[model samples]
Target: MYDIAVVGGGPAGLSAAVQARARNKSVLLVSGDVRDNPLYRTERVDNYLGFYNRSGRELLEAFRSHADAMGVQLREGRVLNILPVGDTFYLSIGSEVEQARAVVLATGVARGRKFPGEAEYLGRGVSYCATCDGMLYRNREVVVVGRAADAPHEANYLRELGCKVTYVSAQPPEGLRPDIPFVKGNRVEIQGGRNVEAVRVDRATIPCEGVFILRSSMAPDDLMTGLELENGYIRTGRDGATAIPGVFAAGDCTGVPLQVSKAVGEGQVAGHRAAEYCDAQQREEKTEDKERM
Candidate 1:
């Protein structure tokens, strides 16, 4: 298990990992493909300290190189789910599950609006991670509304579980199984009673027992079910503390000025607090064990 798992690979995430590593803590920086980061689209960064109008990509490379030099373990995979179990956080990264004592969410921000009825039927018949909930729909039909590169892989997981999978998206999914029906649509909606019954993509309706909605980045509320969010951003303090213990958030995902310097500062604070929290928890556990003796 890692001392901490820092999600996302942007400036905020990179800073968090680097700081945690500096504390001599083993950190697993769980990030998806770098292309998914909105920062990749930025052509130039002029305001960040110590950098003179360098391109965003250049800055990202520097951040990555720094982390690498620190020997931080970087895992290039999307965090499908983060479940708090006892004193540790269990993260689902594709098919593999890893555990960490603390978690830092720096996943930038949620980019798109949720589909109609998606939130209302979240657990009933909708899910975000196929690996987490695919077995529940064994022998059933499911629709995967994918907005990420891994959508097809998720569909395949559902199919492997004896479920009929239909991929719904604006463009044909790459690496998708030929047997799985692909429906091209710009807009999609989930309609059902008690459970998901069908998905309507534009004018076409495809019946299904479940719907798996995958996005490049999940909304803060959806990322951690009970975590507090204010107007779509994770509500965090200057220390990056959230409502949940052992969990923290930083960067644009937290809200506003949306600047690289702001993200870096918040990440540093979060990394430091997370290290302290973990150290304190360990000390308490040791004390309790000693008392038992």
Candidate 2:
């Protein structure tokens, strides 16, 4: 088990891992494969302390390199769930389960709006990670909701999984490659109460075995469950503590003041707090061992 496992490759997760290591703890950094960040491509962030007018990507890369230089072990995996076990935390990352003394959930959200029945069929027939669930619908028709450049690639991913994909768009396909059939509409609705029975748009029912929502923007809670969220942000304490012990969440997960610099500062505090928590655990283990002997 690692001393700390940070569940994001974004700004906050990276910063937390670096500081945790500085406190001499074993660190594992897990991230989704969104290497080409969508936010960095558009925004011009000039309020940053250094680099008066630096692109977000330029700033992000520098931090990534710093974490790499510090010998932080980077692991690529999409976290599905995080559960607090006895004196340890277990993270369900796709097919693997990782245990760590401390956990930092820095997975920034990839969700837009919370629609009814959206979370009900979470793993039933509806899924988020197409790569993981696409195989189940092999040779069957599937639907993708969203009109970003990611639509084509997501469709391709489903195709590679041996499933026929139909890209559903809330808007007319713009600037995107025009190879796949883009079902253009204003609002894409998933028509069902409990499990995804069908997708309805203007009295038209498009039947599908599965539905994958790929909306462009994301909010904080879009990543993990079992957290107290207030206005789409993870709630935290003055000590940077969360509801779960040994799971010190910081940055956007703790919500509010969602800026890069503020996030980094919170990360440093969480990292140190996690380090202290781990150390206390180790000392307790030693005492227990002595008593056993």
Candidate 3:
């Protein structure tokens, strides 16, 4: 298993991996290609400190180069699900699953604005990641929460694979010309406790077996069912610790003042702490072995 699997290729994730590796810990960066910091689309990053006039893309390229120089393995694939088992975490990436001791999510903010219990029943019923849970709801009633090419694309997929889908929108899903259950309503609420029973809409419960919460684009939280997140950000303490052990988060995903300097500072702290924790575990095991011998 990898020492750490940094789940997002953004500034925070990249910096964290480097920090961990600098301490002699092996690191693996599991990120999709487009996740290399969307700020790269912007014209300038003057407020980012040191880079007085750097383009987002240029800075990202430099960051990537640095990560590569340090021998961090980079894998390309959209993260579909992150399963935490004991001390290791498993990431589902399009027919493949990767395991790691820790994960740092920097997948950015999810802004689909399609609400209520959408957050509550994330794993119970509302799931943003289709790739992971799509199979579970085969030929069952499933509602996908999203718009743009991403949402409809997923909806079409479910439909193609024989899922009864309702495209509930924050806004109408774009470019999807599929024959499926497309419910045009907001305020997506998941009703039920340990198991999801139905999705509450404006006037009805759109009775379904499953609800795929696709809000906007993917966030670090959406991929990890048990990771507590709110408003498209991965909820973390000041120390960057998440509800999920061994998984740390930083930067905008942890919420705003999303400056480059802030991300770097948080990344440093998370890196040091995670490394220390992993190191301590190793030492404990070594001691235990000696005692047994």
Candidate 4:
């Protein structure tokens, strides 16, 4: 188990990880594919303090390098959920689970709203992870909603698992298996009664038993229940502490101005606070053990 887990690989998250490591705490930095990060595509970033005129990719690489040099463990995957049990926060990363004493959320803004029946059937017949639920739909029909860059690869994995996969997205998918049929549509809706029956992709309604809605990041509230939000952004204090104890937030997820400098500064505060929290928890546990003896 790590002392702190920072979700996101952006400027804020990298900063948080670096700060936590500075406190001599073990840090785990979880993030999706680096290519999916909006900053990675930015051609020029003109405003981040000392680094003027550098491409976003260059800035991000520098941040990542600093974190790596500080001994922060990096994992590539989308965090599907965060469940707090007692003093530990259990993060479900795709099909795997990681445990941490404190969590720092830096997930950038989650684009788009939920589909018609997306939330209602979340666990019933809808899923966000292909690796986590692919075997359940083997030999059964399922619709793969390609929203993230890696969605097509995930859809391909499902097809290999014997699932009759149909790929749907706003634009045509690159690297999709030729045998897997692709549907072009942006306005999609999920339809079902007891379970998922079909996915309505604009004008077309394709019958399916399951639907996988893949996106770059899950909203802060969706990641963990009881995490408060203000005006669609995570509610946080100046120190980046959220309503949930031992859980802090920073960067675009907290609010806007949405600048790289803001993210990095907030991340530093969150990381430092999280490290302190973990130390306090360990101290309390030690005290309790002594009392028991």
Candidate 5:
């Protein structure tokens, strides 16, 4: 288990991981494919202090290098869920689970709102991680809603798993298996009663037993319940501490301006505070043990 788990690899998450490592805490930074990060695609970023006229990818690479030098463990995957039990936060990344004493949520703004009936059937017949639920739908029909950069790959995986996979997205999917049919649709909705019966893609309705809505980043609140939000952003204090103890938030997930500088500053605060929280938890556990004796 790590002392802190940062759920993003953008400027904020990298900064948080670096700060936590600076405090002598073990940190695990989990993020999706780099191509999915908004900053990675930007042509130029001139606002960040001391890094004028640098491309977003260049700045991101620098941040990643700093975090790597600080001994922060990096994992590439989308965090499907975060369950806080006791003082430990259990993060479900794909089919694996990681434990941490504190969590730093820097998941940039989750683009697009939920589709109709998406939330109602979240666990019934809908899922986010194809790796985790692919086997269940083997030989069964399923729709893969392609949103992130790796969605096509996931669709291909499902097809390989013997699932009759149908890929649906706003644009045509690249790298999708030729056998897997692709549907072009901008407006999509999940439809079902009791369980997912089908997915409605624009003018087409495809019958399926399961639907995988793959997105680069799940909303902070969706990942962890009880996370307070203000105007669609994760609400946080100046120190980046959220209402949930031992859980802090920073960067675009916390609010606007959404500048690289703001993200880095907030990340520093969140990482430091998370490290302190871990220390306090350790102290409390020690005290309780002594009292028990």
Candidate 6:
């Protein structure tokens, strides 16, 4: 178990990991492909404090190098869920589960708005995690609305379960199963009656039993089932503290200017606070053991 688990490998996440390590706490940094971050698409960033007219790629590389030099353990995967198990948090990452005393969410806001009828039909026929719900649709038709790198894999997972999976996206997804039927729709909507009945893409309608909306980053509220959210952003204080005791949030996921500077500062505070929280939990547990003795 790590003392702190920092999600997202962008500037904020890296900063958090580095700071937590500086506090002598064991840190685990979980992230997907760095390029998946919208920041990587930026042509150039000119307003950063130290760097002037630096390409996003260059700045990101620097951030990564610094984290690596600091001995931060980086794990590559998207976090599916965060559950509070007693004093620690259990993070479902891709296919693995990791335990951490404290967690810092730096997942940037690549989360898009829900499709029409999507929320209304959730659980009845809609899902955010294909892996979590794919088995239920075995041998049945399903539509996957993918906007992240893992969409193709989720589609394939569904197909392996004997699901007749049709993938819908604005553009062709990388690493998608070539055999799965692909639909290119810039704007797709869900149509259902009691349960999901069809997916409308432009003028075409494809019937399906379920629809899955997959994104690069899980929304904060979705990641931590009962976490508080304000206007779709994780509700956080200046120190990145959240309603959940051990779970803190920083970066674009917290809201506002969405600048690297703000993220870095928030990360520093979050990491420090998380380290302190973990240390306190450790001390309390030790005291309890002593009392028992």
**Model 1 lDDT tens row, 1-293:** 99999998899999999999999999999886676677777899899988978988888988999999998898887787789988989988867999999999999978889899898899999988787789989988899998987788879878988888889988888889889999999788889998889999999999998999988887777666789888888998889999999999999999998999999999999999999988998999999999999
Off by over 4 Å in 1: 94-96, 133-141, 156-164, 171-181
For model 1, name the residue pairs that clash.
Answer: none
Model 5 residue 208 CA deviation in Å: 1.1
Q: What is the TM-score of each candidate against the true structure?
A: 0.85, 0.84, 0.70, 0.98, 0.97, 0.89
lDDT of 4 by residue, 74-175 (tens): 988999999999999999999999999999999999999999999999999999999999999999999999889989999999999999999999999899
Best by TM-score: 4
For residues 247-267, could you state the per-residue lDDT of candidate 6 as single tens digits?
998999999889999888899
Please give the ranking of all candidate structures by lDDT, highest first, separated by commas.
4, 5, 1, 6, 3, 2
Task: Return whichever of 3 and 6 wins on TM-score.
Answer: 6
lDDT of 5 by residue, 93-120 (tens): 9999999999999999999999998999
What would the per-residue lDDT of candidate 3 be over residues 1-293, giving only the tens digit for each residue?
A: 77877877778878888898898888888665442246667678888777889988887878879889988888765677789887778888766788877777766665545467766776787775677678888878887766434567778888877788878875665667657656777666777777677887777787777887643346565577777867657788877888877878887788888877888788877877778778877887899999999
The worst-scoring run of ten residues by lDDT in candidate 2 lies at: 215-224
By summed lDDT, which 10 consecutive residues of candidate 4 come out lowest? Answer: 32-41
lDDT of 3: 0.74
Write out the backbone clash pairs for model 2. 111-218
Angstrom error at residue 232, model 3: 10
Tell me the spans in candidate 3 whose CA falls farther than 4 Å from its real position.
31-41, 75-98, 105-114, 119-125, 147-149, 171-208, 215-247, 253-256
Question: Model 4 scores what on Cα lDDT?
Answer: 0.95
Could you give candidate 2's per-residue lDDT for residues 55-157 as a string of tens digits?
A: 7888787878898888888876567667777898887775578889988767665545655556777776677666667788998877777534455677777
What TM-score does prediction 4 earn? 0.98
The best candidate by lDDT is: 4
In candidate 2, position 182 carries an lDDT of 66
Q: Rate the local accuracy (lDDT) of all candidates.
A: 0.88, 0.72, 0.74, 0.95, 0.94, 0.88
